[model samples]
Target: MSTYDFAVIGAGISGASVAFELQAEARVVLIEAESQPGYHSTGRSAALYTPNFGPPIVRRVNAVGRAFFEAPPDGFAEAPLLSPRGALTLFKSGNEGELAAFLTNGTERDPIHPIPVAEALRLAPLIRPEMVAAAAFEPGVTDMDVAAIHQGFLRGFRRRGGDIRRAQPVTALRRDGATWRVTAGGEEISVATVVNAAGAWGDAVARLAGARPVGLVPKRRTALVIDGPADLDLHGMPLVEFAGDAPYLKPDGGRVMASLADETPVEPQDIQPDDLDVATLVEWLETHTKTSVRKAPRTWAGLRSFVADANPVVGFDPELTGFFWLIGQGGYGIMMAPTLARIAAALATGGNVPADAAAAGVNAADLSPTRFRF
Candidate 1:
């Protein structure tokens, strides 16, 4: 039996990224159940890279991850991975409280300034002239190249002589003292550590190891690609987020990408867009914009898993010495991948979390899986 140093289950952005980072230092194996890697949430991402978004810890990760996204290592990306696309947050006439919090929370990390109706319309041509009472714009947002980032991590992992095993679902786990026996794809393997980056199926994997659940809930979010205005120039348009997340749209080349911004709780499985959601989104879009999407080119959905507090859990279990967690990233996984992976690897190796992450005020106890222990 080849006793490897680390075994990462699941090949989503979280798993692949952690494996990619740790494989260089230890004998590692990256395992995935799908026929290929990134078939789950990674492939189904909205592919946006707004750093000044998400929780404070997430924002810190996004800020640090920008370097890797902007300039990947050699032979990792075919082209530039980021294209500048700013963001606009629109508030209704009566939602002053929500708008104030948004601006206050946002401007701390990046300059988020209130814009008038004319300014908002100029930033996002799709915003209806009558729907906006107040708005804020963050000009530093960009559309992330998720595919390129995934490939870059894989390339780096492979370059360091890491082994990737796809179509391998881990069926069982047995602990022998400090070592772990992992069975996947009819092959038994042994490893010193098991990193659980299973995304929505995280709790189940922990249960298999007799570890307690961490209160992860998977929610479905749907998105659609529709016909954009042929004559309109939307190259530098900011991502317009409407009040209460009712519906939002961003320009994608000649097409427009619209989302209902719905977070319907669901089981972990192949996700599909609901017809009612589609109808609601279309109605909202028509109500908020002059350009109507008569039909959609594509519509799809993905699960975004979150803990009760909506914070990512990325550390080792206090009870289970060798089981590390990298789950509950919600929709912020892609934007926060670089920093999360690096931090996760450091923690797994028994090193301290970065000073920046600590300064971001992420409490170590808040991320521990032992909180659920009876």
Candidate 2:
């Protein structure tokens, strides 16, 4: 018989963040299926805050979000959220043209400049010298402490008198007159509004609520960690990736963390790392780096959900009055969470986009779920 102003489904990064923003002025409850928050993508994220990444709208969201990462709210987190770590994009001979387009790709916010091949190797000494042709380095990229940021939002949300129900999987969503009855863990709660931030399972959750699917395709991405050269200072190395769509390698502790960069379409569920993906990644790592796969490496996979347009869908549903969509963040969820949370909180409460978000050139219409109807 408990009632709340809002019930946010999925206590992952997306849900936890937006719930924190919404609980500021309204009664809010965060419901999670897992016993712990961020059990999926958020926990597994090799997160980096690079403004140059993602599409234009996501970049704008990062524009507004950078300040938050730079200096979060007082008492939000104990330590700084960011660590200095650069990114290097390698061009293997024929791919120099791609680097050319990227440099002049508009907006000086990228923090990347064309670097000599020698300089690129100095930054990431593992790439095969025979294969590298040209390179670009992004000095503005930084490693993000995903856990701290997620925990900060959750802590702040709870500090503001918000409730969080862990291990509660939302089984049913029914509209009772003007109220939304959300059933989770065999208990039902009525709320004036429901915000769906279920990530890869977004469309499924919408179907459960009797809303139309927004064409969300959950894609699985696999990453692995392997041994690095003993003489190399892997700790100080920059994140390295090839030009165009290719596997990426970075330093994790004393080992090299490499990603297959594969986006295979998949169903929404607890995904496991595909053996073929791991094998393919090992081959790529051996070919790209100066390392060999002497033994099996550690591998994991997570889902990145995207809509047809490859941009995030965030707004009130056109047909369902109180059902809001804050899903489809794709791979840019963590970096874009801060501003997206602000925008979602504002839009769900019958308010316009916040001033800071507007100044960042975020067109709310561009992210509206209604765009999928056409």
Candidate 3:
């Protein structure tokens, strides 16, 4: 039997990163159900780095994460993981409250500021002149090279002597005498601790381990790439979004990537894009912008898993021995990966939040799995 200090399930960005952080200090193994790591949300992410995007704690994590992305560990990645891309949010007549709500949560450190509709039109030329009333522009928003980030963590983990078990679906988890026997694929692994970074299948993994489900609801988000206006230069265009629950558009080369911004709750499974969602997005684009979906576009859907409070469920379970929760990252996982990974590693290895992360506004107690129990 191969024995280790910890077994991290799900080799997405979360698992790969935490494993990278923990392996140097203790023996660690990363077990992935899929043949390829980051096959789900991590792979499907639009990979935008918007500091003002997530909830409060997540925004804080984003602040802390910026340093790591700015200057990653030596040899972590060859090229930069972030590229400059601005985001512009348009508020039609009734959605001014939504814009206000966004500003209230943002800190002064963020580069987001209100702009006039004319400026929004100047920044993003496609918006219909009569459709927008006000705007908010955040110049700090960037495009993340998610694949590079995911692969870098994985490579670092393996280089640091962490074992990897791919194509291994965890079927059973049994604990005996301070050791967990994780049966996945055809073999069993003995480890002192288990970290559930299973993304959308998080609650299902918890149930298999005899731990209480943490109410992880997987929400589907559909995105499509469509040909847009041909005359304008879309390359330098900012991400244009409506203030409320409307579709958003981002320039993709000469094309545009559009999403209905739908958050439909569903059971965890291999998700597919709904036709209605794609159709709705097309309608929204035509109504809100000067662009039209001229042909059948490439489309896909991915699940963003979240708990009731919509923050990540990190830290160890209060009721389960040696079982830690690193799930429920939702749509902010990519942006929060660095800070969250460090936090998870620190907590798993007999420490609290790192000083930098703490200063950046991460409260350990708030992310504890104990919250879900009560």
Q: TM-score for every candidate vs. truth?
A: 0.93, 0.98, 0.96
Model 3, 1-374: lDDT tens per residue?
88999999999999999999999799999999999998888988888998887788888888999999999999999999999888888888877778876666456777678888888898888778888888888888898899999999999999999999999999999998989999988898899999999999999999999999989999999999888788877788888887765677898888888888789999998899999988888888889888877789999999999999899999998898999999999999988898899999999998999999898778899899898776
Cα lDDT of model 2 by residue, 1-374, tens digit:
99999999998999999999999999999999999888887877778887887888888898889899999999999999988888988888788888878776436765578999999898888778987999988888888989999999999999999999999999999999999999999999999999999989899999999999999999999998889988888887888988775788888888988888889999998889999989989988888889989988988998989998889999999998799999999888999998899999999998988998898889789999999887
Off by over 4 Å in 3: 94-105
**TM-score of candidate 3 relative to the true fold:** 0.96
lDDT of 1 at 125: 77
Candidate 2: count of backbone clashes, pairs at least 3 residues apart or interchain: 0
Cα lDDT, all candidates: 0.82, 0.90, 0.89
lDDT of 1: 0.82
The all-Cα superposition gives candidate 3 an RMSD in Å to the true structure of 1.6
C-alpha displacement of 184 in model 3, angstroms?
1.7
When 1 and 2 are scored with lDDT, the better candidate is 2
**Per-prediction backbone clash count:** 0, 0, 0
Number of the top candidate by lDDT?
Answer: 2
Pairs that clash in candidate 2: none
Q: What's the candidate order when arranged by decreasing TM-score?
A: 2, 3, 1
Q: Show pairs that collide, candidate 3.
A: none
